[model samples]
Target: MSDSKAARARPIIVFDFDGVIADSHDVCAAACRWAAAELGHSDMPEKPFAELEAVTYEALAATISVDPERFAGLVCGALEARTTCAPIFFGVADIMMELSRDFDIAILSASDSDLINDFLITHGIWHLVKCVMGRDVPGSKTEKLLALKSAHDGKFVAMIGDGVSDVAAALHADVRAVGVAWGWQSARRLRASGADAIAMVPADLLDLIVVQELTEAPTR
Candidate 1:
C-alpha cells in the first residue's frame, strides 16, 4: 500500500493533556495561584484558576497581567515539580490503548510537551502516543489543529479535550471535537463551544470513536 493510502486508513485522535489524560487540575490550579502571587497580582480568583484548566497559559497570563512567556515558565516550573502528583484518570490508559489499535493517537495541549511526556512516560503508555504538541508548539490550539489538518489531508482527525477551547479549535480546524464530561469544564460549556459530541466517561470516548469509524466507512 502507498504511504498516502496507509495514512488515509488511519485517522488521528488528538488528546488534551491535563483534565483529559492526566488529572492535573490541582497542579494547574496551584501553578496559576503561584504565578499570580509571584507576579504580585492579588486579583487571581480561585474560579479562574480552576477554569485555568480550560484556557491557554497566554490567555491566563493576560488576565493576570503578566508576560505570556514568563507566566508559562512560572507555571511550567511549578507543574514540573508536581508531575508525579497528578494521576491518570480511571480507564483512560485502557481506552488509549484500545484507540491506538486503529487510530494514530497524539496529544495537543496547552501544557508543555516535555511535562506531559514525563507523565506519559511514567505511566508507561508513552509509546502508544505518536506525538505531543503542547504550548511549546508556538500557536493556539486552533492553529495547531489547522496544521494537523493540513498534515493529514485526507484523513479524519478528532480532538478530545475537556475544555471549550478544545472544541472551538476543532471547530475552527474543521475537525471533530469530543468533550469529556470528567474534565474541568461542564458539558454544557463544551456543547456551547460547538463540540461534536460529549463523552460521559472514558469508555464512552472509545465507543464514540468506534461509532464514528463505522459511520464513516465507505459503503462497498
Candidate 2:
C-alpha cells in the first residue's frame, strides 16, 4: 500500500454543473425554448435530446438566428428561472462529500457563474468544492481546463460532464472523461460520444474516481 496522500492525488475531478450535478438539461432547454418561441420556431428541436446534443449556448443559438447576442439576455432570464424549478439528482450532496475526501472537486460548466453559485448556495453544498469555473472564463471551458492542468503540475485530470463539449474539453486537456446519466444527454449518446465511463446513479460515480473502490469495481 502507498501513502494515503499519494493515493488521493491521481486525478483532479472537474465536474460540469448543469447536467451532471443537477437536472440542467431542462434548465438550458428552457432558454432554448424561449429562444425558439422568440424566433417563432414551431418547437424546440433539442427538447428530446434524442442523442444529438447541443453543447454550447452560443452554438445552439445559431439555429435560431444569425445574431445570437440579440437574444442572449432574454434566454438568460428563462434559464435562470428554470434551473431552480427542478430537483437535483438524489445522492448528489452525499457523494460529493465522499468524492471530496480524496479528489479535489472543481465545477466547470457552460452555466453562467452567477447561476451556478446560486444553485450551490441554495443546495448548501457549495462550500465543499475547491474551485468553481465557468464558460465565462477566458477562452471558455476548454481554456479553463488547460489552465487547471497547468496549475496542477501535470496530474491526470478527469472531466465530468454530460455533453460533447465536456468530452472535447477532456480530450483537449488529455484527461479522462465521465458522463453521468443524471444529466441531460441520453446514456446511449454519452457512450457514442466516447466517454471513458458513464454512471447510472450518483453512487455509481464513486467506483470510478476513488481508489478505495478500484479493486471492487466490476470488470468489463
Candidate 3:
C-alpha cells in the first residue's frame, strides 16, 4: 500500500458510550438505586459517581447485594432511563464528526446496542460510526479490542473511555488507551490504570487524537 493510503487507514479510535460521549451519570446512579431497591438491598451506601466508577460491574452487583446474574436486567433498566433523557457532552458530536473524516470511529461500550444506536440516531451521528460493540456483544472489552485489531490489520488502535476497564482492556490488547477525566472515573484512577494520557475535556481528547495521527504519519 502507498504511504498515504496506509496513513489514512492507520487510526481507529474506539469510544466508550456513557460518561465518555453521553452524560449519563445521574441516570446511571438513579438506575443503580432503583435496581438495588428492587432487589431488596437499598441499604447500600449512596456513593458518588467517582467512587462507584472504580468498581467493576460484578463488584458493584456484589456491593449492592444483587446477584450477578440479575445485573444485566438492572443495566437494561438503566438504559431505559438513559434513553429517555441522556444528553451528549458539549462539543462531542462536532469533534466526532471531525475525527470521522480521517479515522475509523467506533464504540465499545457497556451500554445496550439499541440504546447506543438510538443515541447516535437522535444526535444524527449514527453514520459517522463504523462499529458499535455493546456489553451484550458476546465478549469482554479485551476480546472485542483484539477482534477489532485483527480486523483492522495494521491500523493504529486507541481506546478512549472514562473507566478503568477501558484502560485495562487497551493494555490487554496492546493498544494505546486514552482516559477522559470528564467521564465516569476520576483522573487519578485513570492514570493509575495505565492510561497513556488523560484528557481533561473534549477538546483535549480531539487534540490528542490529532497529535497521535500526525506522529504516526509516514514520511517520504
Candidate 4:
C-alpha cells in the first residue's frame, strides 16, 4: 500500500456531537429544563448559556437537581425528537469530508448513538464517519476511548471535543485530546483542561490535523 493509504488506514479523529458537531445547546438546555420541571424543579433559575456550557454534562444535570440517569433518559428522548431539526455548525461537513480522505472520522459523544447516527444521516454526512460511540455504550468516555485504541491497534487516536471531560477522558485513555474553540466551552476553558491543542474554527481544525499530523507524543 502507498504511504497515503497506510495513513488513511490508521489514525482516527473522534468528535463530540452536541457542542462540537451540532450546535444543540439551546435544545439540550431546553431538555434539561423540561426534565428538571418534570422532577418538580421548574422554578430553577436560568443561567447564562455560557455559564451552563462551561461545565461538563454530568455537572449540568447535578446543578439542575435531576437524577443523572433519569436526566440522561429524558435528555436523550428530547434530543431524539429534535434530531431532524438540530443544526450542525456551518462548514463542519466540509471539514469532516476533507479529513475523511486521510483519517477515519468517528464520534465519541455523550448523546445517544441512534440519535447521533440519525442526525448525521439526516444531514447527509453519515458516510464520512466510521463509527459512533455514544452514551448507550456501557462505559465512560475514557473506557470508550480505550476500546477504540484497542480495536484500532496501532492507529493513532485523537479525541476532539468541546468540554474538559473530553480532554480528561482522552488523556486517561492514552490518546491525544484536541479542543475546538467553536463548541460549548471557550478556548480558554479547553486550554485549562490540558488539551493537546485547540482549533480556533472548523477550518483551523482541518489545518491542524493535516498540517501538524498529530505525530507528537501524547501528554502523559
User: Model 3 TM-score?
Assistant: 0.87
TM-score of each: 0.87, 0.82, 0.87, 0.87
Instruction: Report the lDDT tens digits of candidate 3 across residue range 37-139.
Output: 7788776554434665434455678666679658658757666664375899998888899888778888998777888899899888999999999867998
Which structure is stronger by lDDT: 1 or 4? 1
Pairs of residues clashing in candidate 2: none
Which runs of model 3 end up more than 4 angstroms from their true locations?
Answer: 1-10, 44-49, 52-56, 81-83, 214-220
Supply the global lDDT for candidate 2: 0.70
In angstroms, give how far residue 91 of model 1 lies from its true place: 0.9
lDDT of 1: 0.79
**lDDT string, candidate 4, 43-154, tens digits:** 5444323445334445667776668778667767776776256898998999999998877888988777888888888899999999898877888788888777656654
lDDT of 3: 0.77
Q: How far is candidate 2 from the true structure (C-alpha RMSD, Å)?
A: 4.8
Model 2 clashing-pair count: 0
Put down candidate 2 lDDT per residue, 136-199, tens digits, no spaces. Answer: 5657666788777656555644788887767766776667778887676777777887788888
lDDT per residue, candidate 1, 1-220, as tens digits?
A: 4676655656778899888999877768777888878988767765563354448777788877888888878888888776265799999999999989877888998887888888888899998998899878898788887776556553655789888888877777777888998988888888877888899999998678886552242222
Error in Å for residue 99 of model 3: 0.7
Q: After superposing candidate 1, which stretches have Cα over 4 Å from the reference?
A: 1-9, 49-54, 83-85, 214-220
Question: Which RMSD values do the candidates have, in order?
Answer: 3.5, 4.8, 4.0, 3.5
